[model samples]
Target chain A: MSVDIKKYLEEKQQLVDGYLEANLPPIGTPPTVLHESIRYSLLAGGKRIRPILTVAAAESIGPPPKALLPVACAFEFIHTYSLIHDDLPAMDNDDFRRGKPTNHKVYGDGMAILAGDGLQTMAFEWCSRVDLVNDIEPYVQVQIIAELAHGSGNQGMVGGQVLDIQAENTKVDFAEIQNIHAHKTGKLIRAAVRAGALLSGANLTQFDQLTAYAEDIGLAFQIADDVLNVTGTREELGKDANTDAERGKQTYPSFYGLKGAKKLAQECADRAISRLSSFDEKADPLRGIAQYIVSRRN
Target chain B: MSVDIKKYLEEKQQLVDGYLEANLPPIGTPPTVLHESIRYSLLAGGKRIRPILTVAAAESIGPPPKALLPVACAFEFIHTYSLIHDDLPAMDNDDFRRGKPTNHKVYGDGMAILAGDGLQTMAFEWCSRVDLVNDIEPYVQVQIIAELAHGSGNQGMVGGQVLDIQAENTKVDFAEIQNIHAHKTGKLIRAAVRAGALLSGANLTQFDQLTAYAEDIGLAFQIADDVLNVTGTREELGKDANTDAERGKQTYPSFYGLKGAKKLAQECADRAISRLSSFDEKADPLRGIAQYIVSRRN
Candidate 1:
């Protein structure tokens, strides 16, 4: 099962990588610094997890994975913007991300800031341009925009970021940590999955089931991140590790301890798999993704 | 004519102010700094020019100004976000905006970045919620989002910001400056006008004419800004003035000299008012706004 997950993610990542590279704004224009900053962070290697999930969800419907490339690319835009802003001097303040200097470190704070802004707007632009697809209805487009907004706005990632910042150097409870992670990481990940479902016109019942699966996997992914932060090395992670403990950031390991956090992550993965038990073999990728969330080294 | 323009702007400002204050997210539980950053920059005193234009454009058609409040508020969100990002350490590095500490200065760069991101997302959310208005058709809502997206995206403000950043410390031609100003400031201003017109169901002919007027005023506004940056005092501007030349920024005054820049502004304003002469009394506010663009002190 784990081997299948690796193969699946690798295949999907190639597709996502192609879409991302092709869709990014062309380089060499004025504000070249800002555009280059965005492209740098975007093209910097990651697992492409959100986009892969988007493709999987879309494929779970009758549509070909190729049909969902725009949405997959758009989700990456939102995700990349979050990372760029997250690593800013005032936020996480990390100098490096994914083994390279963070956007602000390389491009200066001003252009880095605008790069994030440009990327966020670009996500919506990509969605609007998807009107060329006959299967994607206008109302669905509106729904995707609304979901992306809510996931990224005050009530979601921004809210979680606030909690994260506030949680710094403070003793925080499990519930608050859960709430922060749920909004910060969970909402957008869930939205990515649901956006794929939306593109395929999933019924409400299927959406609810998928939402449950997404919620489980999303939390599991964060927990695994916490675990990796404590356990992985810089070479393996391709960036700073254990920086959470260094910064005293609220993490699963901080509250529950490493072993306990691992246990929680497994439980989440289990719940995520259980949610798709009713589905046919088509749900295998979803299950594989959930397992991948917990088992990956970085 | 100038007196009438002043009165119209003041009246529209009052309405826009009331709506903006009412729409601001309440300081609530969690008390995150990002929320405060957003509110601080948004509520900070300015002329409320963009929102006022939105309302004025709507009124130029048939309805009372109240009907356009959502669209007006949306413009304010975009404008406030731009200001917040512009004040970041990497950009202007300004400590103050609108006579107060900038958002990043008060809230820190990370939260300020998030505040801008949240506000940008909220703009579209506000547009989505315009479903409550019986007067706006669904197609018009789509059009409004499209215009806002285009005006705010890489092709618009973001693109202009990139160009402006690139032009910094580099010799740029007058056409390059015009292109930068058109995307950075003109597009949104024009969109604000077009959005209001579309919301009010203005005929295509009137929409096209109003757009032309908006484009002229928008360019005039930038030229005036360039002129003022050189000639105005910091005490009068409530923010840094002459900082453009100090930073080696490319501005109208930098290339054409102050006198030439002022003349260009006047020409742009003339074109703006010329587009409105075809309308009767309803266009008085628009005409006044064009004149005020070239004449205002700050």
Candidate 2:
């Protein structure tokens, strides 16, 4: 039976939100404005897809462990920090994100930078903290830290951002765009899934299968985003639509056209679902998420 | 017999520079610009005091492990990242650091921001990677990661920077300045020493003694910096003289007169050296560092 994907997402998002709220430094902490600024954007809402992938992937392996929450939330922190830094005046210069002013717009550039920096370090803090996730083997904790760093650092997300920025207003071929997407958004998404599997003690076959599933979905997710920029309304996208083209940024649609991009995205989702076919219905949420990723308006 | 402090520092600095050179992503990497920006600032020479402290602290306990280099370099990454971010136009807007154009001044603000982000994550990567430091126990690695995150994150370095920025051009009490120094710069310094001791397998007693020593020297180091800002020439400071007052930032010298600040620094150095009195001659470098912290012109 198909899962109620919407309800599952909402529930997972709530779980993650609760963890973040309970764990983050209180607003009244010394350096009040720093904590306040961190909360301001971090508490601001999004789909929570990155962290939800972590939870869903872990569930697919087995009943997810208690340690899953902190690891899951770590991905969210990384994602949130990237978003904050990305929207900075020095970077993407976006005024709004998810229907509110970006962190830099609200907190000024300096505090926004520090807020992003704070969140990034906080992610490692959450993952490495023995007190928070005592059930995790020390080796596993170190592995998770390594995974997060590899996915988020220069060779992955940061490097991808550099490619994306350089690609803007330049003639970029398919391979270049692919390189940008693979490293930029795709790696972290893959990391989220891999971390979940690693934490849940997946076997080699299961880890590889999940890795394949994640790769397909990560590409699908990015393609869907590219398509949305062209076809979706501002309200549906939560920010200005077609801004990719406005900025002369290359996307799947820039090469493939809207219909082709949508077709590619659906193909990716199908492949992703197929990769998880060996798993039983315990993975239904993951299957539904793949379907949802390609079809959702936002 | 006294240690040759000058020669010891030069040797340690060279060791750290060699590690950095051999390990960082080559300039020809795919995202060449990001790596270049990271190298531009990271390779720019400094005293490497933080890392040398780590090495010397490890030596004080016993033979330093292979893991010591990575853990030691991690502090420099944190330090250099702080410097890069501090030099951003949005923050301190510093034009130069250590006699050269700052990261933002050369790489532009966006890449400089990403470079800082890269180095920060790289610090975690260096700590977590089992390959780089295989001799270290996984739990010890995790502990080092936790220590670094604690020392550098909001409640420590980042939080201190926020306080420093807020305190600019404002009347501040002695307690406030003390708070700023303890968090902003002091915590990371302490973390450097603690990580060194932890990696070197220092006993609890040795760890406690070294931590006290680190704390004393950290405060002494900050006080010396304040006095230098006021008294040293631009050449000696490698930037500008009286820039602390130029920025309307308060310092130890601002509260206590220069003479009083110098006296306080010496007293801290004395306390720091006293804390290490129980250790044998192996800790001579650490002893020398404490004395050097208060006495150096820059």
Candidate 3:
């Protein structure tokens, strides 16, 4: 029987939330404010797409979902950290995310920065500990750390952020926009997939398939984000709409217009799904995620 | 023959600088500004104490000095990153460091934050690559990543920074002061020595000896810094003097008067040296560094 993608996504999201709560540092750790700030944003409602990708990718091979919990939590921690920093007054300066006050809005700016630093550091801590609980090979765990460091560090998301900030009010070219999107969002997503495959000890050929699938959906997700920025309401998106156009940030819609951007998103979803043709029932959720990315208004 | 302290220190510093320059991402990478900022601060002159500690520890335990260069470079990167972030207007608000304008003063606040972040991420990247070049076990590389993640994260330096910030102008107790010092400057220094021992595959007994030595010297180093902030001139320290007191930040001087703090610093150096009794002549540099910590005005 065909699966309910909505039900599947909901169940996976629930799994991630429960795992995170169980694994994250308790709320009353010595530095109460910093810990509170970390939990406030981490437990705050979001799609949990990155962590879900990790768990889903792992399950697609052979391991149970719970086995990948630490890694999943690590990915979420990094995503949450990036969000907190991006919303700082020095960056995008958004007051709300997903209908709730942003981290800095509630925690104060200094605490907010520390909270981000804490989260980023904790993510690495968790990644380093994966071998302690799981049966993954020691070398593979190191590989996972390398992949994460590569994806999130100066060469990847952080570097992409610098470029995005520099591109403000400039006439950014298509190549530049693609470069920014690939590093800023795409690399982490790719790393998530690659990590899941590594946990199951997948060979090079299989890993390549997952990588291709992640890259296509990653691009699609970015395009969808651009479209949503134009169409999403403040109540739904939990952020101010039209900020991209207002700030003249380079985006797919900026380069290709709304209609062209939507077409591109659909094409990306199609290609991403095709990349998983070799897999069986386990791949369905990943396919569902690609569709959901283009479909979600937020 | 007694080693020339100045010549020995200069030679080691030069080794670390050369390794760092070779390994760091070059300028003209897509985000030129961020790359330049990282290089500007990292390559700027300062005591390469942290990295040198790692290399020296490794040498004492019988590894070649250059073999530990990557791990040593990683230590310096984290230290440099911390300096960049601490000098942010939201944090310490300092304009000059090592006699040059702070990163934010040159790169702007947003870019300065990114540069710090980039360096931190690269530190992890280098840590993960240790097994690539050396004979350290994969599990040991994982351990090094854990040590770093632990030392630099919220529970370590970052957490200490939050506590330090919150303690401003408040009557902080001696225990609280010790906790701040332990996490702030102490953990990274401890981790540096531990990294070197790990590189050399030191047995548990030897590792404990190194750990004890690191902790004592770490505490002494913090006390010396407190003393320097009071007694050192701008030209000698290469940063503003009296700013710690001016900012109302708690320090050793706050708990113990200048004379008492100096006495405590000497005690720490003595204890640190005693911990090195088991090692032969190879441990001389570590001994010299301990004495230098208490004696140097800057």
Model number with the top lDDT: 2
Write the number of the candidate with greater TM-score, choosing between 1 and 3: 3
Candidate 3 similarity to native, TM-score: 0.97
Give the least accurate 10-residue stretch of model 3 chain B, judged by summed lDDT: B129-138
Q: How many collisions between residues are there in candidate 3?
A: 0
- In candidate 3 the C-alpha lDDT for residue A28 amounts to 86
Task: Provide the fnat value for model 1, as a fraction from 0 to 1.
Answer: 0.46
lDDT score, candidate 3, position B52: 85
Between candidates 1 and 2, name the one with more favorable TM-score.
2
* lDDT values, one for every candidate: 0.82, 0.90, 0.85
lDDT digits (tens) for residues A1-298 of candidate 3: 1557789879988988988888777878877888889999998887889888887777777764334778777888888888998998888889988788999899887788888888888888988883554466668778888888888888788988998999899997899899898989998899888888887777787799999999999999999999999989998898788899998788898789999999999999999999989888887888888899999978
Per-residue lDDT of model 1, residues A80-182, tens digit only: 8898888887778888788888988888777777888988888877766645346455566667767777777788777787888888899988898899899
lDDT (tens digit, per residue) of candidate 3 on B1-298: 2556567789999988887777777768767888999999999987899988988788888965344788888888889988998898778889899999999999898888888888888888888873564466778788888888888887888888888888889988889988988988988999899988888888899899999999999999999999899989999988899998897877888669899999999999999989989898788888888988899867
i-RMS, each model, one decimal:
2.5, 1.2, 1.7
If you assessed candidate 1 against the hidden native complex, which CAPRI class would it receive? medium
Docking class of 3: medium
Task: Report the C-alpha lDDT of model 2 over A205-265, residue by residue, as the tens digit.
Answer: 9999998999899999999999999998987877778889999888999899999999999
2 or 3: which has the higher TM-score? 2
Estimated TM-score per prediction?
A: 0.93, 0.98, 0.97
